[model samples]
Target: MTTPAWENVSDAFMRNDKPYGGGAFRIRDSEVMTLKVTGPDTPFKPASEWKNPEIAEHTEPWMNNSGERLSRSTASFIRGTLDSGMTRYFQQQAQDGAWWYSKDWAAQYISTGWMDFTRQEPVNGLAPQITRLWRSIDGGRTWTQLKWPEDRNISYLKFLDPQRGYAIGWGPNVWRTADGGQTWQAIALPPMATDYRKPRKQFDAVDLGPDGLLRVAYYVGMLGEVRLSSVVYRLPWDKAQFEPDVVLPDQVVVRLGSTEEPPGHTYSIYALSRLGPQQTDGDQNDNGKRTGAISMWPGHRNPAVRQLQTFDERYSLTDMDVGKRGVLLVYAGDSSRRGAPHQITLYSQDYGKSWKDIDDGMTQGGWFDSLTNTQYALYAYTLRKRQF
Candidate 1:
């Protein structure tokens, strides 16, 4: 109920132009709102140009099937031009930094969790919070909040091709959302003791395999207590659910790739993990920077974690994306170093095993925010401030 402390934050995603026409989504206000760019002629506009863009309001309350009142926030999670030329977007009511969807935006999903810290004593030794899920059909112009049971607080949602998808979070429970976010069915997972005090096993990322199956990746205490352990749960698209859980050593996995091109949508999944030692206590890099590394799974079965030695060490790799155009990695080299651009980007055709430079020659101060891929083109969003 408290107003979130606001700072000027904005970002944009570009859809590659066919040598002529392209589009972009300018995200602003912690992703609560966006300014859209329809393309070929639309150049990159600075945040100053859009300090205050046009705004609109909706009249109806966002509602779910169970008749619960789901209010819509002015914010949005993502926006872009779909391959069909339909401008679409999705967002949640609560302010949390996570999202799930298809690359095409045919099906979209998002969730929210409310924290209650007023209790003198923590429930189950952890602050109590409730989560909800929501969906949008017409590019976020309107929303349909889905009905979930009182005990459920869903955390993450990911969809493959708009029809096949999965959700995992608070229950650490695995859910299937095949009807394009309208409803979900629970698929039982290995039972871990639920403690309100201890940290919850969070589901961080999910990817589709090349064989057209689903693979989910999650971590336990990897970023918190310094005990690094993660698991990749694989499920087929057709069966109600069967678990093929692949567990890995202590490392935080973020971006996952497939043996075939276009990443996230294929099988034989390969993933990127933070390398070197992570701090044993606390969060947010009090320990130090983790050199980047890549891990691969040849298939949903018995995949090994190996160091990708070919990745260049010159730049501190920070972010990554994979698509038909290959892989894109963001580098934020140390400004303290004698001669390095404040930030730059690199690309890889053969996955993360090797990388090549793709800098736009901006040497002042620019940081990569997000990389998006559509069927025909790839887009990158970055933030830059004048050195002067």
Candidate 2:
């Protein structure tokens, strides 16, 4: 059905209930557009409960720049309860950076979406970007911004489960949670070999292995350039520290996030080997693409740190993770030298041994619900809950 002419679509997503249970989405006019699963006709419901709540002052960028610099631009966040049949906005601009909000599908009583608000504080004329993690439990009705340590430089955030997650980074890496992110505690990382020359013990990725060990991958580099050795730490899920579980060397680790269906039950990562350069043959062909081989770690049955083929394509990877039966869902941008603008979603049931092009020219973001085999893709201003 065409979008209502009276108001514009504020955001779109599936109801997250049983697949094909046509539901509603928010529009700009404080109304809900109730969509039918099988029909084109949808009715609108007035959402009068949604109102702008009181918030802190503005100083950050509605576009860019830090707070102390104090530019004229402003910023805010979208907050409102989804089940309440409405939408509302929150006022929040701080000393620096940017905020980007996106929508996701809802299945149970709670729906969720993640937004990263970056606070770029310039030091000696250099602005180092600090992205603060946030999650909305009530379907984007409200967002809880997680605390990020200033001392920790690089972090890879993952949710093993909604309430249990981990944030691993360089500056004394690892902040964990067992309460669905309500509170996060710092977890000490296991010590590494002493490299006085400022060796980069930068944590690259973390995943729960099928062997019941938590595998943590980090780059052992000299001043940030990777050396020829590979190391993946391991620890029991119940344990809070690490011990070496080193894996194969020479490949760069490009970590993908977890699945949306189970939230964090399935974790995946890509070990990329630099092929140096490439010239693609597609319309969104790439030039000088850095990837040659793409190996994925899938399933709870595979040996820990074991890499499997997910895709042979040299396209630029945007995101990837495992779904039901270890099926791989891959999102890619143009294979171009710079990549992106042209996006595609691919799925493979038997790892990457086989594949399906779900959307070749997929624009905007998509959250794949494996349980329903539905792709909740946000296009333009409308949410298209279409099936693959």
User: Best by TM-score, which number?
Assistant: 1
TM-score of every prediction relative to native: 0.57, 0.54
Model 2, 1-388: lDDT tens digits are: 1111122233533333222222223333233333222211122223442233343333322422333233322223333333453233332322322222223422111211212333544454434333445565554455666665443443445444456656555443666677765677766665552334343345555665433455665455432243544455666668877765544456545553333333346545445433332222473654445543446554344336545543544566666655555566667665533443666566666646766554345454445555444445555545555433
Write model 1 residue lDDT over 280-348, tens digit each, in one string. 566666545555566655674566655553344455655455554344343445433565354455555
lDDT of each: 0.49, 0.45
Q: Which stretch of 10 consecutive residues in model 1 shows the poorest summed lDDT? A: 1-10
Model 1 regions lying over 4 Å from their true place? 1-74, 77-92, 97-106, 114-127, 161-163, 190-199, 210-212, 218-231, 239-250, 259-268, 276-279, 282-286, 300-306, 310-318, 325-344, 357-388
Task: Give the distance in Å from residue 380's predicted Cα in candidate 1 to where it truly belongs.
Answer: 14
Every model's Cα RMSD, please? 12.3, 12.0
lDDT of 2: 0.45
